[model samples]
Target: MQEAIIRGAEFDRLDMDRVPQFLTRLVTRLCVDEARHNAIVKKMASHPRLIPHSADDLVDVVCDNAEAQWLAARLEAFSPKDRKLVLMLTSGFTRKEIAEELGTTPQGTHSALYRIRKKMVERYG
Candidate 1:
């Protein structure tokens, strides 16, 4: 969406010829994001600043909000470190970066993150 791109890119600075490539990059990032955290992706898709433009988009907004809220409530039940791990993961931290932040080995971080992701997907997906 224009707004999504504009939020991260300076409209005047964007090369008109690269619009498709730019969109492709966004789509790829989002696809990866959704794989990591479907609820987080849904939450971002329902940007709070915008009103839905159609009946279908409105339904999507409501569903997204519900899923995001559900995920938030579930996150509260996790250990403090686990919650922070999930937060960092959804915020786009690489596993190595997360391991550094959490003061753990990359392999440990990977396993913990995988466990968390698996649990969430099993229960919520």
Candidate 2:
């Protein structure tokens, strides 16, 4: 409910009469997406990992070494909470999902993201 209104603030205008329906749809969509995300996460957790035997299968190793490690070093320099937030965002958590996980409002989540991006640009760029 609160999340919907926070998200709604992004729109310049909405049909005054349909506002309830609009918020209902927005919440419903978020619920559906969250359910799907949970199911996918569960499925992946139960899936087996395949061992890399060929060069192609090892591309991830090369890529991770080249970029992931570099970004990881910078991410490590953040405060524990900020580092966790960055990891959550990278792992496909929605703003609302992150807010729920962090026990914060969506507006706070958005503000944190903005601050994180600014710090990254200013300190790392």
Cα lDDT of model 2 by residue, 1-125, tens digit: 67768767766785678888876888899999999999988887777774333332245435423443445468867898987876676565666788899999877977886787678789878
Give one digit per residue, the lDDT tens place, for model 1 in 1-125.
Answer: 76776664766666778888878988998898778797766777888766455332455445534544455568976788888876675555656777899999877976886686677898778
List the candidate 2 regions with Cα displacement exceeding 4 Å.
1-73
Top candidate (TM-score): 2
Worst 10 residues of 2 by lDDT: 51-60
What's the lDDT for all of these models?
Answer: 0.70, 0.71
Pairing residues by index, what is the TM-score of model 2?
Answer: 0.42
What count of clashes does model 1 give? 0
